[model samples]
Target: MYIKRSIFSDSFIRLLAVFLGGAIGSLARAAIVIPLAINPLISVFLCNITGSVLYIFAARICGKNLKLVKDFAATGFCGGLTTFSTVCKDGAVSIQDGEFLLSFAIFALNLLFCVASIHIIDSLADKFGKASK
Candidate 1:
């Protein structure tokens, strides 16, 4: 039997990657929101969409060998950049305010776009061998 060890297998390195990536992602989100001063709904929409696309591409590119890319980009960066809680909150508030249409729109948009982006990116990656196994 043979064992393989990668730098990313170290718990410390993984933790560091996640921490640094999360910090940067969060800062990036703040930078966009602050400078744009967009409405919460719009901001959340943009963030989730962008994060979804980025996550899909990064995950594919990272593949199996590049655990660092998976940790930093997909897990930490995308996790920090996209706010599911915020989207849920906004939806709930909209519903409470009798804005059912807006709430539905947000919910649908988030789901559909995220799912579609993942599928599209994955297909493209497979076709182009973004991260060949």
Candidate 2:
């Protein structure tokens, strides 16, 4: 029987994707964070947004059949690699630190750039897909 991915009803394979994805992403987040005492929230902003875009890009580029790559890299690696929780925390901190303007700008930047990046990738994939056929 085939099992579709859902928050609850996902089978072992899908669950594996979620679990491994979260783990790897989390580790990568730490790796990006540990090197500097600089504002990590900005770093998180960049990471999550970029990761989100790539997630969409991967989905588009791989089409539907690239399950293994999506599961391991996009879902696991990217999920863990991005840190929404940290983003929120940093946003709050930035606001409290009298950088509300900067914080708001960062939020907008992430949302805008992430959406654009995904579509850009999708467009590239579409072009390549047609050319190959």
Best by TM-score: 1
lDDT of 2 by residue, 24-73 (tens): 78877777778867777667776887688878876775667888678877
Q: Candidate 1: lDDT over CA atoms?
A: 0.86
For residues 88-128, write the lDDT of model 1, one tens digit per residue: 99999999999999999999989998899889888977777
Q: Clashing pairs in model 2?
A: 21-76, 25-80, 25-81, 26-80
> In model 2, which runs have C-alpha deviations exceeding 4 angstroms?
1-10
- Model 2, TM vs. native: 0.75
Alpha-carbon local distance difference test for all models:
0.86, 0.76
TM-score of 1: 0.84
Candidate 1, clashing residue pairs? Answer: none
Per model, state how many residue pairs clash. Answer: 0, 4
On the 0 to 100 scale, the lDDT of residue 79 in model 2 is 76
Q: Please estimate how well model 2 matches the true structure, expressed as its whole-model Cα lDDT.
A: 0.76
Q: For all the candidates, what are their Cα RMSDs to the real structure?
A: 4.2, 4.2
Give the worst 10-residue stretch by lDDT in candidate 2. 1-10
Q: How many backbone clashes does candidate 1 have?
A: 0
